[model samples]
Target: MEASPSTQSPATKARLRTKTGCSTCRQRRIKCGEEKPACRNCISASRGCVWPGPEELDRRLRKFREQLYPKTTAATKATVIVNNVTPLSPTLLPTDIFSLAELDLIHHWLNVLSDLLVLPNADPACVAGHSFETLRMMTGCSGLKSAILACSASNKSTLSKDPRYQVASLRYYDEAIRYVSDAVADIGHGSKAPSDMLITAMTYLWGPDGELDARKHVAAAITLMKIRYQTAPKQICDSLAASWWYRVVYESVLYQAFFLAIRKPLSPDFDVDPELFQLQGESQHLEPFATVLERQPLILGLPLSLYYLMIAVIKTPQLPEAQRQAQLLELRAELALWETLTDDDKPDADVHSKFQANAVALFVLATSLLLDQMCEQCLLAGSPAELTTTSHTRWQVFAALRLLHRPDVSEMWKRCYLGAWPILVVGYSAHEEEHISSIRSMLRQMVERTGYGEFQRILEELEGLWASKR
Candidate 1:
């Protein structure tokens, strides 16, 4: 009782033919001799050939499979249940989703930017692995990805002197700002603590123009730390100390805060709350803080204790004259101790470590000189011995600067842009023409070598200072 095949409806017939050929062949309504890259039919017809891209093809195949075999049976349901428990597919990770441009930026980050961001002494393999893991965890998150890309692009702009790179960086920064703002707002609503990605993104929101107020970001980061984890100082310290990335970011924030506090303490826009970072009463927490610094000595190429001393100096201005003088002397003694330790250790350390030691020593010496000047200015009197000591420290600082300028550490200096703050401090404290000239030359070379335009701002500020002094 079956109907004849010729009379059968077209819908009842099986479809064995696949539309895998070029678009030209498909559009022409002709059979296509499917070929890789180009179909023979299109070639013969002298037509342009275009095929589905990988994502399109994948979507098409997935749609076809789903349509062909719709799940129905109990066995199918059981299979789905098992699949739910399986590990995430590799395709779901960052690699499969990144655009070509994003991939190139990531490659650059892995090769260069990672070195700039991580602990200087951290193993490259370990840092790369950590970065990869971070990317994987943040696969679909634009905040971290955009931040990383923005940083890379900004650096590229400086290096290549291409304004287009800066434009791209700004675009990425804008996108990242949207995501980070949302996250921060959510956290403000008592959603949860900020993630590592969010924290890291906050750290990277700065641009070449130096328009961003770093004190704001630093304060936000510290505030989040306090609000999220109201635990004892030890628990907080332990958690942060366990992760080198956290430590690096924290140290960087501290470095920026110290620099801003020292350079523009009274500036309205740059003002930060001393209580937010007050460690004076956290005597029990000092051990943990010291432990972290001991383990990651000079990660950002500055003595951690120097930051503490800066905080002490800032706090001392509010104290009684006698107490302030006592604290200043104590700070001076600590600076002297650091200078001695770094000098003794420099000869036995590696080139990178030696550079760090000298960099820290340079800052210590400069800080000592500045502290003496503060005493002389505030008291309007300085003993003959204090004047001699100040002169000696200035000479020692210049000597350390010369050591840093040596050929052996040229490559080291080029890689370490964190030297910017120390260099600026030294430049600000320099009085002699020869020392000022040396500092100016070093700043220009640092800007040229590291491609950090922020240093250019520092150079300009120093120029203004020198002009005023003249």
Candidate 2:
């Protein structure tokens, strides 16, 4: 074979030449330009540029470090010197058990999820340190961290239509449930007072977009708050400056309870908690718990009057028929008081709803319609009052739909989460094909922008309702 040497170069014969290249090129056993985003080979082939994930990179780095400095002490392994230049320490790398994928999800939480959880704050100065405070609260709780990861993953799945993230979301969700179960078991021992952190963990476990049942998570949060109120009544009365729990736990539980009330009607046999009613009564007072009564930054913001009224509505189903009707009338009056209030001392209704189809107005109108519907369901249908209620409900539905189609409100509706309940109410009451189509379009746009699949779920329910009507 001393014949003329082969013309081919050694580079062409190398088997591991593209080992550090894009996944597709490496699989194809070809040279890669190693370009970012998309390599030349992938672009030409019209293939996706799939890079190694964080976990894979972490493993590769660990393997390299071990080979370079095997079985070394901490000091020796701390820094790896190269050609008289000091290199970054190996310890500086992410060496913890928490994978980089989860870290990315946490980053998503900081950037997007937190903002989605609440309406814009009225006072920007008060929220200047909110991020640090939230991190401190989440630092020690594994269950809370897992719940957050689960939510983040679910959000990503919705946006990207990726099956992998959904799988990961479910796994983290199951782990969170197990951790919460263990924590509840520990609570039976009275070893720890139900702190706001633990209670907040329960609040985060409510999966709005996932397939998991949310009722249990909400019930757990309510139970934990009840425990806290019973065991540490003093803590409940503390000022916001003294304890952040007063705002976080109270508002979170209240918001969840409000939605639960809307979605699942209370059974006649369900017992009303005495503390819940006490909280409702105290919210109407001017002093003592005035700060508690005042609306803080919340997921749902309503007039102080409306907030209290919703709590009563949530409990109304538990009352006897005669008493329930009386309570409903009382709530209707209270709602009217807020809607028409122009007293110097009272909150201006316009301040809450500047837009024709603003969230607050939509909510008030929707709640009004809901109260009337409940009355009809619970009482005999032939009363003169029934005609007025039905007419008023239809009027509110048409008003909401008209406002919804305006140019200005269309932009607002794209970003607002609070419109959800009202939109659902309008969708349910809507019978005409045009009206139904408009509501469906708005929901689809919201899902496209926010990646909140809960809207999609609502859309599905509305379609099912429409199908039945046809």
TM-score of each: 0.68, 0.66
| Model 1 agreement with the true structure over 1-470: per-residue lDDT tens digits | 75577977787555333545555777787876755335688778788876543343334334554674475445334323322222111222233477645654565455456666653546654465556656664576778889878877887666556576689888888887788789999888875667767877766776423456456666676666555445456665776667655566556555555555655321223444555554567534344554574565435456556766755554555567768777777777776776676456545668656666666666666566556566664575433222222333356556557766777675566456666656765666566788888878877766655567767888998799778767
Candidate 1 weakest lDDT stretch, 10 residues:
83-92
Provide the lDDT at 306 for model 2: 59
The true-versus-predicted C-alpha distance at residue 437 of model 1, in Å, is 3.5
* Residue-level lDDT tens digits of model 2 in 222-242: 777667765755557664435
Q: Which residue runs of candidate 2 sit more than 4 Å off their true CA positions?
A: 1-97, 121-128, 137-139, 208-212, 234-236, 239-246, 264-274, 280-293, 311-331, 341-357, 374-393, 402-412
Candidate 2 to native Cα RMSD, angstroms: 14.4
TM-score of 2: 0.66
Q: lDDT of each structure?
A: 0.60, 0.59
Highest TM-score, which number?
1
